[model samples]
Target: MEPEPTSQRTSANNSTYSAAGVDTAAGDLAVELMKSSVKATHGPEVMGGVGGFAGLFDASFLLSYRRPLLATSTDGVGTKVAIAQAIDKHDTIGQDLVGMVVDDIAVVGAKPLFMTDYIACGKVVPNRIADIVRGVADACSATGTALVGGETAEHPGLLGVDDYDVAGAATGVVEADGVLGAELVRDGDVVLALGSSGLHSNGYSLVRHILSVAGLGYGDRSEDLGATWGEALLEPTRLYTSPLLRLIEKLPGGVHSLSHVTGGGIAANLARVLPVGNWSEIDRSTWSPSPVFRVLNDIAGTSLESSEGTWNLGIGFLAVVSPDVASEAISTLAEDGIPAWQVGTVGTGSRPSGDFESGAKGVDGGAVRLIGTYRDGAK
Candidate 1:
């Protein structure tokens, strides 16, 4: 072969790290695109701008509390990102990340103060990065949290260009005596089930598997779903912080414990917040499962027992409240646009005689079981 021109050879060789799949310039551009969104979430509490090496927030508010307790939670939007990638929709996934991380802090009755995110991808696509951050910023703003900082890592040889994963951590503050869960939950407390927006970022591995086996693609539509598979599945997780926080403030000590239903479903998660000698029997007949869940179960030939353990199956959160305030709490959530209902009640059970950790912060968890059949009617 004839020798190539020197200028052409030099130009080709000068491509630098872009040729290796990492683009430094693109990363900088991505930061620029998302800077405004990140800063938009900041209030008087956020001290520095977006490009800081570390996020700075004013903790002076903590001094106001009689005894301040800090609560932190970290989580990631699991394989659900695969569906987002498959459908080329990047916006809603960040909400899923917030739902996973920030909402966990809310379970302890904390007020979310700030959040940071981490995204890993083979390439830093500026617009895609902006889309993800914008969603995060929106959710943070709604939850009164500052989107202080984030890291977008380019993994050249690891993830594919379209492959990416997002995770985040959040910190919040509450009065020491105001901390929720096992310590506050008691017998006869009514369980209020908060409605979910959809799957809410869990059980996606099985979701993808079931769809794969059924020969369905993200673009495919079903008469049962009334929308594209991707659209139905990608419904952003409901932001429960605002309403739940309002309930806490309104009811005071009436709101005993809170549980964010996630990976292990209603029973396991609800169990995490119950006292050692107390148990809850959830009435499945209280509310009907959302259409998406019913469709998934029917198509996959999965039993309710199997699906409930993996998916939310409709309920996103549960609030264990005193019976006297359950009606008011449900009405309050309803007025806030969240459809909530009395789903069950707490009961006493024999405690196992030993000092042990109760899956949650050294507190003891009681037995929890889902009883009754699912109501067939849709809400």
Candidate 2:
């Protein structure tokens, strides 16, 4: 009687998890698609590859250092992902993620060892995921970092199928004595502005606002930009890790501090690594903002003062170096194809009053301001 008549449970509706928005099979397929690119970033030191609960990496090399301090950074592409989504371009956003995460490690003079990424999307579109992971792997390889593992989560109802956000975490190591920043920065240190590739994964909220106010879409082409808005805005964030790592190694003690200019613009970021007592006046005339920035400013009719706090303007990274070695650093960076110039100088002064004196995340630091005016197409 318990056995009763044999019956198989079946639903009139062919329901599946994919029908509910999430597709585990699609996620697995994405993993298969991205495996090669992820592996390409791994070296002999990477222990276990992808598809693991946790990534394994060999830290035995750190044993050689007298005192190795690990540096870790986590960052996202921010609202810049909106631009990528609007443009339907997924490849470059991963590079922006890597740039934001790994480059911060470089600021402390650490060599990036490995990176992991997180992708949250409403649906797992295998091709799009592959494009993003491929970009991440390419960037990790370029920066000499291993892409050991990552996770892609599909949240069907929480976000739109076409909407996604990318973030990454990177770990690096530096000898304790080799960490670069405020401790090494001093008065008379020259501030060099490393030119940006474009608006490197920051200030896009303002960018979108201006574009919308001007009644422009991502596909709109501007004569000034020489490309569609999407193409211009999607410029991948420049990876400063390699060039900067080389600069630090080639000229030890020459680079005092490095500021990765992202969210808070030049003054704010540069102030982060500056000592409290010293101030810096960055000459805005040193380099012109990229056309994308200039166009947005023109369209929005925003003042440089208003934009300074939100955008990188022109400079992407600032290097504080001893004046004696400034020229060498500039020349070496130039040889590496990174255009840099002395944009300001550290001076003796008390931290200024008001918001200007506050560094990134409201940490107290020296006064920093962008003086003068942006040059017209200085390049």
- Report the backbone clash tally of model 2: 0
Q: Positional deviation of 269 in candidate 1, in angstroms?
A: 0.5
Give a tens-digit lDDT track for model 1, residues 1-379.
Answer: 0011112223344367567666766777788888888888889988867765678888987778999998999999999999999999999998989989999999999999999998888777888988988899889988988988788878868899898989899999999999987888777899999999989999999989999999999999978888999999999999999899999999989999999999888888888898777877788888888888888888899876679888998899999999999999999999899999998888786633443223443445877777779898786
**What C-alpha root-mean-square deviation, in Å, does candidate 2 show against the real structure?**
6.3
Shift of residue 314 alpha carbon in model 2, Å? 1.1
Q: TM per model?
A: 0.92, 0.93
**Alpha carbon deviation, residue 307, candidate 2 (Å):** 0.6
Off by over 4 Å in 1: 1-15, 350-363
Q: How close is each model in CA RMSD to the real structure?
A: 6.6, 6.3
Q: How accurate is candidate 1 locally (lDDT)?
A: 0.85
Best by TM-score: 2
Q: Give candidate 2's whole-model lDDT.
A: 0.85
